[model samples]
Target chain A: MSRPSDVYLFGTCLVDLFMPDAGMDAITLLETLGIRVHFPQAQSCCGQPAYTSGHPREARDVARSQLDLFPGDWPIVVPSGSCGGMLKHHWPTLFAGEPEQERVVAIAARVVEFSDFLLNHLDWQPVDTGPATRVAVHTSCSARREMNVHTTSWALVDRLANVTRVVHDHESECCGFGGTFSIKHPDIAGAMVTDKARALEDSGAIEFVTADAGCLMNINGKLALDKATPLRGKHLASFLLERTGGKS
Target chain B: MNSQPVTLYPSRQFKDNARAALADTELRGSLRSAMDFLMAKRSSAFPDTDELDALRTLGEAIRQRCLSRLPELLEQLEERLTANGVTVHWAETPAQANAIIHGLVAARNGTLMVKGKSMVSEEIELNHHLEAHGIQALESDMGEYIVQMAGEKPTHIIMPAIHKTKAQIARLFHEKLPDTPYTEDVDALIRIGRNALREAYLQADVGLSGVNFAVAETGTLCLVENEGNGRMCTTVPDLHIAITGIEKVVEKLEDVVPLYSLLTRSAIGQPITTYFNMISGPRRPGEKDGPREVHLVLLDNGRSQAYADQQLRKTLQCIRCGACMNHCPVYSRIGGHAYGTTYPGPIGEIISPHLLGLENTRDLPTASSLCGACGEVCPVRIPIPEMLMRLREESQRPAGEAVDHPLRGQGAAASTTEALAWRAWRRVYASPGTYRLFGWSATRLRALTPPTQAGWTQNHVPMTPAPKTLHELVREREARRKES
Candidate 1:
């Protein structure tokens, strides 16, 4: 497939509120590649929280609101794989039997995760301008299974010549920030994140990068609380922009 | 027959149970090592991804085809078994199944029944019922034997004693059995268990086992196990009884090829188990050393209810490989006992609601992080995560909502507050204006964000919004671009 001249950025809710810099960096990286990025102001949450929580009606209502925003044929690039999966894979199921089913399916077909859009569509190969640094990559379950872009995320990171991608133990396991699951079963979620944090820290990386904001927040929050280690996490978009010398 | 109720961890106390299980360092270490080993074994067993995918697709198609004609296949199975001189019994409930088995034993004046590993028997609390009626149901499978000897429920479907370390098993044997010395040596432990169970096989008036697959076309009941205990249990006694869920039936014996291959490989990474017993019927005329009577008890136990819905019928496709639990992150963390059901982990979360009702197993569905590992690793391609989400929907549906097929105890976990919160979330997110305003205010008042956020803040710091929303950042960039 040829690279599109224009694309729409679906900055997920977590990126919009908790990590605005990541969203901005995503636009910067896209723009640096000579592609015109369109940010639709009407976009909001992907309704994944309610969708996975079994509230389909509410999830549909919220998800339906964004269907009209991306009216163009340009690919919709989502920085977070979790939200990207909700749009690409689950929207059809959410709108099944409804009049908007075709519309949702068409929109879902154009949905592309950030790493996948960069690695596959554009074939991005960035020149490393930053200092030598080692970083670990954390792939969300949605990215790994739902969107099937975990390898693309890793390959995108591996493109940086100066960055040494360290592999963590249980790299495929969940970081346990399962939206409401963290709030519902905190102890289990805590145990999962604790193990994930320890693994990342033990990987000898100064920082970890993930393509999903939920995991970034969960891992960083746990690391912030633990004064024992100074290891923190960064969103892949920002990390990529930083390594590629794009102004953040 | 009145029997002592089977000991249960009670799904209602899932939170407490998970907390308790997580606190046990020994159990955590054992589960961690076991899961790692099993995962590695399974991965290496199927080194070719393309071949694995093709096999899984075939396995799924076979199960779906069999389930599409479940009623007809079940009837055909009964007819073929009957023609082959085997008694086939249908049970709609656990109590009815127990009564049928108890009556059979009582008719034979059986004082002891040597049993192979059977989770269905555990589901019906058959041992307790038999013991209540002056019958001893001795578990002959090594794992099941260890669990029964300790008077504890099997923690895992495939490996009942997986939770117990060898040292723990040695201590259990030394304390529970007569004149048994404590020995942590694995070989010695197996010898001791085998010796103790050897006499029970001969003394048992009846033998019982579980069927992995019931072939309707061939009238053969297939049993897969690593140990020879299942074969011994079926052949040693004068009478043998096999119990299984109604969903275990396959239309043709050939259909079992892909399923059996996938089951062992996905389960413990074994290409084939040590013993694969195919019992068609009782000893034929002049046949040597086979049981005189063979009976199969097909128990519904809420399976028909699951079969009623097209989407839910997929839950019946499970081959009981226990691969889902082994691959599940939540199961690895909390272990199987924390689930408090006959089947646990991803499969249990979906199936338990049907068996025990959503009200009794409300928390089971929501126990996972929606990690998708179980669904990915499933041999027969059971969409376990999707089924879990569906169960969660059933558990929280409105009290009086109408549907084509309502699950038992629907809306058991529904909460007015949770519903209202989602409603509020929809209202804010569904509108561009409200969402923008909410984001703006949230960021502006980020300092007022509370330090403690119920469960989230229990371990980590509070989540504070950024000073500027993406909407604002994008707007500023657009303005600057136009000005430049």
Candidate 2:
């Protein structure tokens, strides 16, 4: 199939509320590539928190609202792998035998994570006009298992000529954001996040980049609290936009 | 049915046990190193990824075939065993299994028994029963012996005393053994355990062992172990008793080959164990030396319950390999003792519910981060994360709600406040207008948001909402662009 000229953008709840710059940068990144980005104002959360927490009834209700928002044949690009996974893999399971199953099947087929869209769908490369910077990419658990974006992000980052990828240990494990899990089980969550932060710091990278807003928020929140820390967390859109000279 | 209830570890206090385990730095260090070593070994075991995937597929199919004809295969096994002069006994519960073994020992006038590593026996609490009845039951496996001497249960399935360091074992042997010099050298400790267990093997009146696979077509019991103690326990004494769960039976002898290979490789990275013993029957008339009489006990401790359900039957296909535990982040961090159950880690969280009940193991399924590590390493391809989610759903259902699943309404997620909140959330997210209204109010009241959000604020800075929603900002940006 030929690539579409325009696509609908699903700015997940985390990006919509806590990190609006990521949402804006994602659009700018797409628009700079000659593709029109459409934002559906009626779209809300992807209901991953409820679905993963074992509340399927609430999850179905929330999933149905967004399932109808982007009704066109345009690819639905999401900035977060976690929300993208929910849309692509989990939405059909939530509406298995219902009348909305067809809509879910159609919508799920078009859902693509941000990095995956850049590498696979658009087949576009970034123009490297920025300074050299060494960064480590944090691939969220959902990205590795639910979507194949974990490997695609490496390819996406490799497009920048001056950007170098730093190696780290335990790079594929969860950042412990897990939506409501961090709040419910604080001690366990703290232990996990602590391990993640130490591993990223040990890599000697100046910035930690990830495609998911939840992980960016969680890791950046922790890194921001420490005054002397050398590392900064950046979303894939912002990092790509900045490195490609698309950030105006 | 037996009258007295068997005493098993209580998983109801899992939270408390995990807290205690996390507090101990020494244990955390041991578990971390052990898990890392095991994971690395397993990764290197299968050099060709395609070959490994093929083996896993074959292994899963073998198990599925076995379970599909479980009842018929079990009866065939009993008939074959009876024809081969090996008596087969069925146990419906732990108490019943204990009673049957006790009766056999009493009939033989046995006073002492040496045991190989058997997780089924642990589930039945056989050693405690024998002790209560004034009979001596000793563990012959090195790790099991250490835990038995310390008056503690085996924390891990494969490595019973993985929680202990060499120094701790040296101290344990020094305190427990008479006239024994304290030595922490690995070889020295093995010599100490071997010498002690050798003496027990001769003096004991009965030899007991656990079966890794019970073949039905032929009445053969297969065992795989690195230590020679399993062979000695089954061959040293005149009377030998082999106990295993009924689900361990497979349809044919050939089916065990791939499963056994996967078991050892996934377990500890061994291409094959040091000893692979296959016992079919007792000593024949012309046989030189073997057990005079052999007994096979089939323990059904809630395995049948797991079998009755379609989705849950996958739990029984486990070959008792510790790969899941070796890869689990939670198990690696807290160690097995924190789970407070006979079995621990990812497998324990899923199967313990069927063995015990959901009420006792409600907190276990929630302990995982659901990172899918266990599922990725599982030899039989059991979806550990999916099962965990199913169990979590079962645990949260109301006490008596009607659901098609077998474990409905058996969980602790039935809190009224949480239900009401989810209902309210459904209302807000289901409607775009309602969601926008809440989003506007949340952005406006960002300063009024609480600084401490329950347990999260204890460590993390409070996560306050942003000043404006992305849609609101996008609208303003579009209007300015139009004017320009």
Candidate 3:
């Protein structure tokens, strides 16, 4: 069974509403590799917010609307590891023993995060250009455990010429965004992100990148709030595109 | 430890305790360093991932098999224990267990009881009960002795005094111990505690210990510990009473091998604990130095409540390794004191609800970030994050409504405003047209969105919606492509 040449992009709710540039960069990257990308018109949210917030019934209703968006078995690529993990790992279990269980299983198989799709499925590689810079990589919990996209992101970043991959303390620890968790338990979330910010600063990296939109938004928000913070956060899609001389 | 059931519902104060703990910089530093060290040790212990993963699978399977046939196994355990001349007693609640133990002690006219570190005893509050009835039970474990002397509870299960520093322990010893000078050395502090406990062991009329594993086939109660105090407490005294939750029983002695290996490795990162004491029965004719009478008290508490439900039955599979707590981000930050339960951290969050009901422990399940670190490090492979989600759902249900879950009417339901808002959100996202309208409005009204979003704005910049939705940008791109 050969990999699919074309795929559909699940523009996550966070991407659609919060950062459309990332979603567009993902599409541009796929098309640059000569693979046709389909953006379904009806897709909205992956229901992760409701699902994780303890409203499983609502989560199912919202998730059910997306169960048939890409019906022809073309792979469904998600740019954010948080959303990709939800679709690939959690959706099947959420609908277990239900009417849509079979469809959920089939959909789960085709779902892959952007970096994972690029490196493993499409064999995408970036050409090195000599511009020395130290950059730190922040792998979201979902990216690290659920999809194993951290290794792919690391490989992608390491391949870029003259870019030193600096290691920091506790890189794999959560930034504590956790979607609603930041809002619900802001103190703990704030403390967690503060520690993450310090680690990034201590690494002396000019910029940090993450594949998940949730952590990017969280760490970036924290960095933006602190005027003295010397670090910047970017989505892995935008970072990869900039490094490879592709349009953002 | 109180003799009667301590209020398990004190988890309601979790928020307040967590706030106080967060403010304590010293506690935060200790917890951070301790958790980091323990996590690194555990990872280093299992250098071979394949072997560790396979062992975890076997450990999980053993627990599942035991729980699936729990009733049959319990009967088998009783029969085997009786045949071995070990008296097995059953208690359904904390009060009953306390009464049964107290009766056993009173019958023997026992004045002093020496205890090994037992979380179950803490759960039943046996020491306080014994104290009230004129029987003194002294904690023989160094950490447990310090906690007991300081008039505090065991904060961490394995490392009860983990929250204390060497200097603080030295101070505690000088203040509490008889004729003890202040010495800020680790070995000196251990010597102080050892000297105090050695006399108690000899003078203790009865010995109390907790079981790490109860083998049904062989009727052997296995105790895992680094110190030999557990052995002293169980063997040196004339009478010995070992108590454990009903869920600790396994089908055969062989099943304990993988579990013991994982427990030791995951617990303190040792290939094996210093002592693995397995006591099948009291002394027979020629046995030189064993207890004359051995008593086994099987306490249920709320274990059957957890066992009756299929999804929650996984809570019973825990081997009390403490790896989950060590790796838990929330626990590391807040420490165990904030949890205010007999068992604290990830395992406590899932199991406390069953013992104390959901209404009291509602905050505990919601306390985690759902980071899944606990699940990854768990030796028995307990799906902690999944259970937290399930408990969250249980918390949002209305009281007395018809639900099939075992924890249905047991929750402190969410406020009406929260429930209504969630329902409205479901309505909006269920339809594509409605979602598009909401998204468009959100983008247009981005400027009006509050700069201060529920305390998040205090540390983070305000959340600003993008100027245009992806759908709108895609449509514009399509129009340009068509023109080209």
lDDT of 3 by residue, A1-248 (tens): 35577899998988888999888888888888888889987898888888887788888998998877897779899988889989999999899999999989999999988888888887776785546889999988988878877788888888788788898889888888887778777777888988999999999898888888889889888989997766788888888887878863
Off by over 4 Å in 3: A1-3, B1-9
Q: RMSD per prediction, one decimal? A: 1.6, 2.8, 2.1
Measured as a fraction from 0 to 1, the native contacts recovered by model 2 come to 0.52
What TM-score would each prediction reach against the true structure? 0.99, 0.96, 0.97
List lDDT for all candidates, in order: 0.92, 0.86, 0.87
Best by TM-score: 1
Colliding residue pairs in candidate 1: none
Alpha-carbon deviation at A172 in model 1, angstroms:
0.5
DockQ per model, Cα: 0.87, 0.63, 0.71
Candidate 3, residues B148-226, lDDT tens digits: the string is: 8777787788998788777888898887677999999889888878877888889889999999999999999999987
lDDT (Cα, tens digit) per residue for candidate 2, span B82-168: 998999999999999999899988988898999999999988889989988978899989998888887788889999999999999
Segments of candidate 1 deviating more than 4 angstroms? B1-6
Worst 10 contiguous positions by lDDT, candidate 3 chain A:
A122-131
Q: First chain TM-score in every candidate? A: 0.98, 0.97, 0.96
Which window of ten consecutive residues has the lowest lDDT sum in model 2 chain B? B1-10
